[model samples]
Target: MDYVFTVRRVSKGAFKDEPGSTYFLKVPEDADDISPDQKVGAAGAGMPDKWAKEVLAAARSGENPRTVQPKGDILIYVHGFNTPTTTMLKRHRLIRAGLEREGFEGVVVSFDWPSASSALNYLEDRSDAKQTARLLVDAGISAFAARQTPDCEINLHILAHSMGAYVVREAFDDADDRPAVASTSWSVSQILFVSGDVSASSMSDGNPKSSSLYRHCVRLTNYSNPFDAALSLSNIKRVGVSPRVGRIGLPVNRPDKAVNVDTGAYYERNEDRFRDIPNASHTWYFFDQNFYTDVFQTLRGDVDRNRISTRAGTRSELELHVA
Candidate 1:
């Protein structure tokens, strides 16, 4: 049984008929050109039951014949604010490509939520988007567990960016409430929050040990750059506080009980490259090769002493107007 990858768009309210988005297994070199609407599974259709069955069987038996080399479970990605549907698809594809480039062989799923392609629309859909994310997470976890593959370990890794970070957090926080959704006692291996805007207060409001959010997560890695201007703007607009990746703030070694990854040093090392790329401030984590490499390494629990850097640094200059 090989890991089956699927990508699809889920829309809310009145916009349901607009070609329900594309989700498919990512291929090399052509990530940017693939549309979320393009079907990748059987018959050039949508997500097929056969693929789901294969995934469930593999999860139960721990044998995935589809992959070149048997690997762990799956990795799901959720994109951020002001991102169009096509852009989200491309980003997810690129992420899968990057992971493959690093020799990872596992199913990759991209959960696409409706975004209005405007800052105000992005803000308006935040809550609804979070709800969507919660549904997908629950479904993915349950689908894998119910079909348990005897020899394989079904682990889930989530990589969310900006506002998508909020979605991931909310899903984890609400996992226990959704009993209808499949439950996974297996801890989440790693949660990578890339330039996330979520506040520390919200993250720490509930008890660390008792909270549903903290119980499921093992290592929480936040990729935050002090030089990320968009994050600064988000901080001012949302909670009037500074941005902290992985919800860990500055002047403190850690945030209450969350693990933090300082991205300031990485930014400093690649300042020239970031500055050269237009609109690169908000997307440094994905755009920078070194940043992606470091994150991939961190998720694998392979700590390179050279990659560890400052957990806190000065905020970037505010460039985007958040009116």
Candidate 2:
């Protein structure tokens, strides 16, 4: 079963593009096999707390009974703009499927905030993304942080894609203002951004805009593809914004813990294989096995950044190798 924690309002048995109270859901991979009447109801109030306990317990106990790995991590996937709830869940399953194919045993969860599922609604989605950012902090991150034990062997991580990067940055900013310990003191292990949609300058070493993000994560890895047409300079949706870190790598003054990996070389060489995919440059990572290999290594937290086989060059300027 895949876990989903959504903040999208339900309308006529489907998720609509409007913010709503947070709810936790457990969806089996074969959910299509079951009728709508057989579907379970959403968890009730205090559900986030219970959900966190269940997730932490599962993470603490290895999913595979014979494996003795001391640690298991949960990766909270935050999707980009223009994605409906169905597409969001599909991506969650694809991510989990890719990770499992590489022998990953940890759980994958999603934080699905409302996104106006239209290509023309970029500005509208951005507004909703900002409005819903606090929900990610209050319900997702803080909930898990409160339940984590002092000696906990499990790690929590985040993988934000495209505009989801904006959501994450804003979520940390919102959490910074909260007086509660869970909100202010929470941290994650690895924070990865694929096709990040935030401005490059905002994440530079000394920029106050991302100060809270820098303070909270142990490491931040950005996967940039210069060929991403969706984030290119000509994209009208970003008319007045500066260059994106997802299209152009991080600014020269990036934080000490931040690393940029240019995936352009690999993508260009493999572009033919992805020609059928819409906006392949920006969305191809999840569909590539080699990409998942790199993600798996990153989440394992043992391999040095420069030593990962799927990448080449120094840690400061790595290039994703073509598989």
Candidate 3:
């Protein structure tokens, strides 16, 4: 039997529902409930308390109802552009299942910001990501970090894919301490940026607009691929922006805080599995066993880059390769 899927969703999309004996509700992408548009519109939001009382509490619950504490970490997943809530839930479940299969002992929460599920709505999705960024930070990341424990600290890891990277980047507002603790007083352990859709130089050192991202996490790992088709569209559309971190990897001038791990070979090694996924290179990471193994090692948090067989780069950067 599979473990019960536990996902605390924080959505920024407006909800449509009728009050009755049974609830019938839906969150449409646009106000018209027809065509998608590029606008920052949000209906309502959720989380922080429920997350603390239920999801976070699962870590210690003797019953272990959701199997949240077996691994000792909280892995929050933020979905990327043009994703529907149902697809978001499925992806989150897939991630948790993969992690469990790979010996990860923890819980996975999906932060579902409203993204219309059609490529035509790319602009709309971008608007939604920016709108939901703060909610993800204040209600999602902050709430989990504030959870307390006596014996062991709850490790936090963020596995953000594609355009979701922008949301994660924008969400790091208050966390600013020795290793980027939130103003609410907590630190993220590892941020696993799988195919981040943000500009290559966004997180580089001295980029005043995005400096906080460099300070907070013990480590920032970028999982990149030169062949990400989805990000290819992003690059073409957003002409001025440098190549996405998902495509060309981060620039050499990036802060010493971030490390780039190239996984292009992993896709070549698992071409059949890549083809199995709808979008292949872009979505393959979710289905790839190699990806699950690497993510498992990252969450384990004991290995260093040098010992992991890394190559030195122009700056103080390391290119970590996963066999």
Query: Best candidate, TM-score-wise?
Result: 2
lDDT tens per residue, model 2, 187-282: 898999999999999999978889889898999999999999999878877788889999998998898899999999999999999999877888
Write the candidate numbers in order of decreasing TM-score: 2, 3, 1
Q: Which candidate gets the maximum lDDT versus the true structure?
A: 2
Please list all clashing residue pairs in model 2, or write none if there are none. Answer: none
Residue-by-residue lDDT tens digits, candidate 3, 1-323 = 11111122323433211110111122233222211121122223334243355555444323333444333677888888767656776777779889889877677766666666687777767876776676666656665665555444567778999898988887774334224334356568889888898988776778754676666688888888887887884545565666788988877787766878776765676677567578778888887665787788777766665445333333344443454
Which clashing pairs does model 3 show?
71-105, 174-183, 175-181, 175-182, 179-216, 180-216
Error of 1 at 145 (Å): 2.9
**Better lDDT candidate (2, 3):** 2
- Model 3 segments beyond 4 Å from truth? 1-51, 60-71, 174-183, 233-236, 308-323
Total clashing pairs for each candidate: 15, 0, 6
Model 2 local distance difference test score: 0.83
Query: Each prediction's Cα lDDT score?
Result: 0.55, 0.83, 0.64
Clashes of 1: 15
